[model samples]
Target: MNTPKVAEHIVNWLKEYATNAKVNGFVVGISGGIDSAVTSTLCAKTGLPTLCVELPIHQAKNQVSRANEHIKQLKNRFDNVSEAEVNLTSTFENFKTVVPSFESTAKLDLALANTRARLRMTTLYYFAGLHGLLVAGTGNKVEDFGVGFFTKYGDGGVDLSPIADLVKSEVYELATYLEVPTSIQKAQPTDGLFGDSRTDEDQIGASYDELEWAMQMKDAGKTVEDFSGRDLEVYKIYTRLNRINQHKMVPIPICKIPNNLK
Candidate 1:
């Protein structure tokens, strides 16, 4: 693909979309990942007011540093780009104290992680409402569709998605074309949700490369057995995740009555 041309097209598209929407500008949450970096850069390219919010809820030191560096770079490159940092650590702690917890030990960790994402979502929307900006989502195609790796109504909640069509690998390509900070471009991908350091692959059971390939196969009407790779386990893991997380990938189902009944 022509990376630069595609990047320029997306940038222009964002500019026009925001203009037509009659909104003030774009508000994006910077996670210091390739997806966020590229998405924020695209917003910056619009030359409109762009607010990059760094909401750290006990975020890792390195992650916070990367986010700061990204904001610095964006501010230097785009005159209209601005930033805000909201530390949600105390808020999250208070939330955990008051909210009732599930008795099942099996699901508590995941629940807490999702809560973190939802908190960030709430922060983004708060800023969006205050500034009359739309929340630009950072999720890519592989995670957003293939495995549904994002937290629903959390990272998944957004007014617009600029990179949802590109897979993880494509996001890296776009990041390179956009000259996203080399450190962020090379850093391992994480959601910055959990207390401990765990890469997305750690939680997803397969690397993004493997997941992208499996997604392609599945889209082509193939199954895990159809994959030619020697590692059967990888294919199994991909297919399992794809099946289980399909709910997150699709629109919520609602009960409907037949027209004949009417």
Candidate 2:
């Protein structure tokens, strides 16, 4: 509903999660976008030590700047706001060098893009483990459970998602309620992978609004024929992502032992 109540509910929910999981605080990657801004704000409101990280590659000046702005905003809202920046260019290059025939400029879009997501997740978990805080995913419901716009074992792996119930549009509303900076709120949603060539919406082939609509219909257990053409396309992407990334979302499996023999 309103900003304060929405924020309060998120904070309370996070606190309960932390208590139940026995965690000291929460950590999230602030990508200088609305989703991260609102997520950071919620973590701040929880009064926990919220650590925001900025993972930048070459030519990501704008995203890096915005991430700094996000950290500034968080400082005003929370007491334990701190930031760490890690450059991923060298690591990305190294990975490519070691893997024979691993082309960084691969034709397969997911191959290149997923590398960035995985790196960001690594950096987030590094801090999460060091600080004894749970990694708070910034993915919204539309992205995570909807189109599956997250990388398997990457952004998809998280201790908890505070905004998992909010779609992209709802996240913006919450951002407005919290008085998040206009620049951060209105910025284009991007994964900041290729800076100019690649973006979240570009790869997903639809806007968050379109994806949300399709997700709502599917979540309600509606049939596919009921959806519009654009919505149907988005739903197709969601279904494919879910099937392809099934292993990433599930726990590790072990070889079964014969009960009678044991």
Candidate 3:
């Protein structure tokens, strides 16, 4: 891809969308991941006020540091860039206290992890409402469309998605072009929702590269019979996730009323 041209295109598109919507600018949740870094940078390039909000709920140190580093780098590079950090650890704890307790299980862990994302989503919108900015999403093609790896109505809830068309590799390419902090560019991709060191690869059981290849194969009408060994394993993983998470990829289901009944 023509990195410079693509970057400029996204910047112009973001500016146009914001102007058309009559919003002041964009507000993005900085997760110290490649997607968010590239996305926030693109918003900054539009010369509109881009607010980067950090909502950490028991987040790991490395993730926090990388987020701070990126925000600092962005501010130095773009005058329109601004930041806010909201620590939601206490709020999360309070939420858990009110909810009924359950024995720790993988299901419980997953639910709580999703809660963290929803809280962050709420916080981003709060800032967006206060500042008259749109909530910019930080999801990419593989994670957003291929695997459905994000939380629904959580990180998946957004006013706009600037990089959802790009794969993880392309997002990294943009990150390099945008001069995002080296620490963030090098950090392992994680949701940081679980409040641990588990990487995205660990959770998905496939690297972004492997998932991207599987996604391409699926798009080309490939089937399970196409491979063997680890290739088959990865293919199955991709297909299973794509099948189970269709709800995230598609629009919400709405029951249609029969015209005769109405």
Candidate 4:
């Protein structure tokens, strides 16, 4: 079955990579989201030391609790696992001071969203450097590969992504198999930005259900010859994300080394 095989591959990859890389452990951010929770569990299952960071800005107290619960689960499984919390409220405020126009412009919304994401990545990298650990990414296939729901140079930058090929719904299945807490299992997924003013689904204009269906249809060599108005709209949204976020999904351009052999 896909479940057992995927789990085995994850365990094998993490252990072998850690030993081969000579790294002592891994650092992953736990956003109280399913993707991160799954990644953290997979990394911990490898028996390596793991650090889980709770990086919250405008979320409520329950967000912290949920993140801690995920961390606790990881700690219970891995002996060397620990938790850290970093508040970005002050830093976000400081950055706003530099760009006064950011206060009133739409740019502020995106900038803040990006700032939160990058700050978490920065923290994970810090511990990764100090502890000689790799930074594990928490993005799944639907979000990362299909729609690119991560911010560039932020959550998108990581040493490894254990579940980069799994879709959003598939991730839920894995989490259930791994016995992730019920609270986390049922919690609404969000980026925890702007006091939860929106969610990934809200911004995407389609649920993961529809996204997965579309992906499946495409994968199965099927196409909607006659798309309804709603279907056409979803297609446009998906296509737009693919086009606009291409840069985030690719490596930075580098100088080409040309060889002219006569």
Q: Pick by lDDT: which candidate is best?
A: 3
What is candidate 4's TM-score against the reference?
Answer: 0.91
List model 2 lDDT by residue over 1-262, tens digit each.
5767777889999988888888889888878888888888888777878888887766467777888887987786668887787888788878766766744554644676678789889889998889899998888887776666777767777888889888888899998888888888878888776657466787778788877776776678876677667667787776676677566555778999999979
Which segments of candidate 2 are over 4 A away from where they belong?
A: 102-109, 227-232, 238-258
lDDT of 2 at 57: 62
- Per-candidate TM-scores read 0.95, 0.87, 0.99, 0.91
lDDT (Cα, tens digit) per residue for candidate 1, span 1-262: 8998889889888989999999988999998888999999999998889999999988999898899999999999999999999999999999988988667573888888899999999999999999999999999988888888999999999999999999998999999889899999889999989877999988877899988887777778876566565456677877787789888888899989999998
Ranking by lDDT: 3, 1, 4, 2
lDDT of 2: 0.79
Model 1 root-mean-square deviation: 1.7
lDDT values of the candidates? 0.90, 0.79, 0.94, 0.80
Q: Which model scores highest in TM-score?
A: 3
Q: Which prediction has more favorable TM-score, 3 or 4? A: 3
Residue by residue across 1-262, what tens digits does model 3's lDDT show?
Answer: 9999999999999999999999999999998888889999999999999999999999898888888989998999999999999999999999999999999999999999999999999999999999999999999999899999999999999999999999999999998998988888888899998888999999999999999999999999999899999899999999999999999999989999999999
Residue 83's lDDT within candidate 2 is 75
